[model samples]
Target: MKKSIQLNQDNLEQIGNHIPVPNYNRTSETADIVHIGVGGFHRSHLAYYVHLLKNSGEASSLCGIGLREGDQNLHDIFKKQDHLYTLMVKHPDGKIEPEIIGSIIDFKMGTTDPEAVISQMAHKNTRIVSLTITEGGYNFNPTTGEFNFDNPDIQHELRHPNDPKTVYGFLTAALKRRRDAGLPAFTIMSCDNIEHNGDMARKMLLAFAETQNPDLAKWIAKEVTFPNSMVDRITPVTTPADIDILAQNSGVQDAWPVTCEPFIQWVVEDKFSNGRPAFEKVGVQFVPDVGPYEKMKLRLLNAGHSVMGILGAIHGHPTINACVEDELFAKYLGAFLDEEATPILGPIIGIDLEDYKDSLLERFANPNIKDSVSRICSESSAKLPKFLIPTIQENLATGGCIKFATLVLAAWCYYSDKQADQNGEPLEIIDAMQDELHKAATATSSDPLAFIRQESLFGELAENERFATTYTDMIQELYKTSEVKKLMRSLL
Candidate 1:
């Protein structure tokens, strides 16, 4: 048996044939970017891009600042492996391409020491402070489209500004120091999946800053530039199985290997205060306005994922690949896009609508990727509004077909029942609003609007006669039988 290569800075040369190893001298590189959340998607996406830039000998490197205590796993793995990890992109044809990314030179866990993370952000070399802290991390109320000031973390940060606990706290404090010291502000870039994410980040950061110091908020509004971006890549949470795949296939044992589809895209606005890396060289699109692209991606791809994820979970599909394998589910997804979502969509520059839809189906069905249904299913409360609700709202405005989108919500209500699948295995309800959703879903026996009536989740859409009727009907049909193919067919 061939010996498994232990992944570390020293082992790069030994595994060059099996995986593309970075030839850049990582030790000499300084941190040009400080990414807030050091998770799988960031590893396979942004950091990977920086790795490409670093390999070109651009001297641009990264420092990962972790927020969640759960991120300690990343800190431990990167620390032990000399900040090296494997990125294995799987193709539909069963070919796996592995690359050892060496872009991240250091990591600081904020849960342990906020001061260190703040210092890294305030550094002169840190030209960009990026974030992938998930959708919920922004601490904004999804319904109101404003910062949730009542959040304990935001409150804590406001009270103890210097020794901060949240992203806002760390950002505001760091920027304040830089401002006071007369250093140029680093670009506040958000790589998350929110529409107008740059604006959202700026708003929340300034809101938090205002609570601490209004002067600081004013300075940030004037000095810092938060560039909106549309980032696309189906990066699943890495499983233990992925680690084993790396060890057996690539002759490398990576503790926290990031696996993703070969397709990756980033469309970023060119508005940056400080300088940025030459990300454009690595296929990152510098767009005039990311609005159209963001909508295209969020509605079609992300919203499509939620529909499949919820219904797939109820159908006992383990992964997205399995969901697309079912012809009925694929047809449902296509119909959802073409009939319900496409009419609401504006023109996407240089993208064919049909080709993009087909590509989404192909990407979802890549058998090797093993993207989990539950991973996409989690946080439906936040995702539905961001991804799907716009379609519903627009359809209502334009008088288009909304049956498909309504059914997607109904599927969510059914899936949120907190019960087992047909196999009698317990279905995990993983939402911030789990208890309320579960209660509402389970209480559909009394009032079908129990879940939909949640003002934060559905807003006034539940009151619409057309949507209300369709949603109620979906709930009734879901209760009668687990099969939804016929129901989906009826919409078409």
Candidate 2:
């Protein structure tokens, strides 16, 4: 029996008893943290944590700010429900735990009204400006690992500081106001998946700020704090069917409900300019340094995804679970984690590497999540550098086993060049540097080093005989044989 209850502040109490709703007073809450790039991950991870804290009567709320024109859809969906949405955690055995999260008190889009968004960021009550912008959003040079100051958006920001478009622009404008008004600058926490995310955010933001206003940039540098955080949880892209399923199973009609796997982890550095919620009481780990934990997640979990994503894509696997369900694929991924990725990492204080690796395999194999392989495969140009390249660099420097890592890189070359599986099925290819990658990969016969020679992404890896030799060999074998599984078996 499906009950009909549209999700909103007015109807939170009306939602069926099966679904958990916020018990606190929503009317009195104001924005404490202004989050940029609001989407599924934000809802499930940060918002989910805030919802938990608020359940304990914590005085903190999230004000989501969407910066892009594409974010208008966010306005359409979140505004309808008074920024209320259901988070449905899909367990491995097909059970769901639905909770109505009320941590987000307001949502604003810079696309509609930039002034409102800037004002919200500059407000006295807004003590933190956090972000979940994806890896490429930083606008940093992937090779040199520096903030790209010449980016048109940065230039546009310098030219017209008042009318801002990019996140950097908005932050610069708002920070200027705060400085001029003599209000203390807020903490700039980055919950994105990048390693040392807070540090990277600080570097990139400061670089942009330096270009426009050197004096204000110095003030921001002196006063502001950026906390690096390692956030984890697999929240797949929400589907139309997800909405319907939530309605059917939980009887909560949320237009853009979030669905994710059961597990979640947040490790934040204990550094903030303004005060932060007592998040540690609600399962958030606040440590002195988030470096070890972040490196483990990035090199193991994120890198593991790329190992399977590229190989599974070329073999025509539709979803991550389906791909891992294949015995050969599973074996190859496990060996890559055990033999290649795990070797370079230093031991963390509390974590067991073996347990973490096993858990990742189980997480990827969760049938209920149906995590998309193509979704994992998206933006490999950005992902590979952050995830896999570190392992490669570390191995090459230490003279460790580069076999599995090299093969994965070669597999990516094939995936990029063909843009289709062996059976001629078209793959869903999405990458920022696709044109350059495709061009370099297709020219492998004449210039075996062409792909890795792209200094922006690969740096000098192409010059290294050991890596280039294996990459060239495996790439040739892939094009010649096209038996992706057999290739894996041979490597194993």
Candidate 3:
């Protein structure tokens, strides 16, 4: 077999695969958007759109900002490939389409040069600063919804003005530089799954700036625009097996590849301080308010993930596809939506709720995209409050069926017990509050209210007799049966 050529501008002509390459001249294009947290999802979903815009004769492109400690790997890979990477889109019918994404014209790791990262954001031409820094990256209190001023990095940034570590620090410093240089403030767009993500970003950044400089804080609050967006795509962490497959399919050895489901959606609130991209020219939705779409995705899809990921882990299911393949699992998810989740969601424009729910089941059952249950199971401390608890709360308010939501909360608590799965393999409990969660979960086997008693997560909500009873009964049921599938089926 011929040795596969490396994915780069110089090697584009050497490739023989049918995968489309960028049409624009890479050397001439400028970075108009600087994206933070350059992970798999952003590359697959957001940068894919930028690739479309750039390839369709648009001048703007994206430059990723990697500030985390271990970002050197990303820097090295992008440098090796000239910022060119392949995205494998897995369709439901088992067809995998590979496309080379070149819109990410530049990428800089802040670990080596923090100042350069700041400068990139402060650059005059960069109009948009977007993020996909996951749920926990925001560092906000789940209960209070306030920026964690007491976080060590935030404290360090506060003490030392010249040097900084956190994203909040970087944004504050960059915006300050831009303001001083008489450049217009860039729009801050958050693509995270958190509800009201743009609003959260604005609040946190403003809070950070207020501590550093009250004037700068006021300027950011008045001048900058933060647009809320709803982004959906199932892009899992790239594995070695995926890389070898990309090599075979594309005949190009990509150092770091991204694989995602073919279904992609982005709904952005059409608000920007500076001029924005003509993203609407492509398939991006430029809506007046992203609230409805955001709510729908978070409640139905995200909460459903929580339900499946945790329950699936307990039942020894590895990947999401494997979990959804079970008839009991599928039926339980259907009941979850029909009984609990759907009732809480308001009417979304142009969306038939029933059809949307059906599509979600189909997407989850996509065998080609092997999104893992364990991946979704990570960071439950941050995720459950934002994703699942809202539905619980609303269900309580409306006097709706809390059975399925209660079961999900119970599943999470039981899964957190450091207990072994059905196969006798120990399930890894990963969370910021790992030890505490473990202790609480162990206690819940004896005292059902132990986990919910944590005031930060459950608070006064647990004090409600109806929810408390339902939760306790479900936990009790878990203790009786190692077969979670049977339990869920019984509930259905």
Candidate 4:
């Protein structure tokens, strides 16, 4: 017989002895809003907050939509368990607390039934359509944050509008349907890690709409609202251990489980088109402006990760905790944040750099959360501009030191080459620039300065004499040292 779908109260009470459960409710009624990209981060952060609001009898209109196709296992599990799953939050102090979240009422595979996605988007009751689609899904140019219209997906969608091919196409078709039916435009809230996420979404949507209907694009610009947001949480890829723990604690088998660190934050702009749920009651900060918050996160938190990911991975550290525990890695991370990142971020308001740095260290040292260097280092081309280059440019503009920033660039160049270490083991090079980087590394060039002058990669930075000279010096140092850890120690 199949196991019953019920939580063991005895087991819950036993675990309760270890971690105190906050008096937050965890039951939500049917949902009215729909969320795209139901990944680990969404499940741990947004879904948990929505569940709390539901349990507290505050918001009853929030549903989720999972986008991946051919994933019947996840759909079946949610169906059998009444759309409920336990989110295990692992605290930095090694405490685990499991709470049943029930805000998701349904799931639809967009690739399987595209019409169904369009139909749901046309629904008048669906007031907000939030997206957690990662940076790559946006079909944006890394150098220019604009939509890539020449992409095959966008081209296909343009040729065959009836059968939508991309997310942007589906959104435009759905909006067209709403326009014909006289439904109000839903607010488009982006919770991705990209800088100015709201603005990016708006720009892409408008660009897609303008291809066929300029009037529609204008109307959307005026009618729809895209609120900028800064979201923070260390949600690692789920492992087999997480599955076993969840099944043992919750008495329900979840096919797609998520585990995350205890730290969570969501800062959103206070703007909406049709209507919005009362998310403020569940700890979402609705501020008049989110620029300062966005800058703080994009620079300090994300930039710090970029600095540690390359250096730590070179030292053969797998997880963030492993890197933080190493004395050298810890000190390098501190210097990068304090001396390099913070100096450029001094102009941003509403940010306590010291407190934020402390919180970041604690989050990184969370042993229970297994964040991987490979995951953080992926898509460096898209991430570097948003996280690192802006700080570099700011420092240069203000006559600040660019030594550490140059070292970071040099480390990124070395990481992208996909070389082997002293042990002859292959190193993982995670980035979209893999092919280009390989070509650059293997080119017949003996001078490090010539290598730094690659226009395709550095753009205007290669033309700047001071920046190029510094980058050349770092590249030479890296080649001579041949050890990322040693180079980092010397710089610190």
In order, candidate lDDTs are 0.88, 0.89, 0.87, 0.74
C-alpha root-mean-square deviation, candidate 1: 1.2
Worst 10-residue lDDT window, candidate 3: 12-21
Tens-digit lDDT track of model 2 for 69-183? 8788877888899989999899999898889999999989887799999999999999999998899999998999998877787788889999998889899999999999999
Taking the tens digit of each residue's C-alpha lDDT, what string does model 1 give over 223-342?
999999999999998888888878987789889899999999999999999989888888999988999999899999999999898878878899999999998889889989999889
What is the lDDT, from 0 to 100, of the residue 250 in candidate 4? Answer: 48
lDDT against true structure, model 2: 0.89
Q: How accurate is candidate 1 locally (lDDT)?
A: 0.88
Clashing pairs for predicted structure model 3, backbone only: none
Candidate 3 error regions (>4 Å):
16-18
lDDT of 3 at 145: 84
Cα miss at 484, model 4 (Å)? 0.9
lDDT of 4 by residue, 342-446 (tens): 876545565678988988987888888878888887777767778888777777778877777678787766665545542446776766667776667554137
List the RMSD of every prediction in angstroms: 1.2, 1.2, 1.4, 3.8
State the lDDT of candidate 3 residue by residue for 140-218, as single tens digits.
8888888888899889999886687888888888999999999999999999999989999998888888998899999
Per-prediction backbone clash count:
0, 0, 0, 4
Q: How close is candidate 3 to the true structure, as a TM-score?
A: 0.97
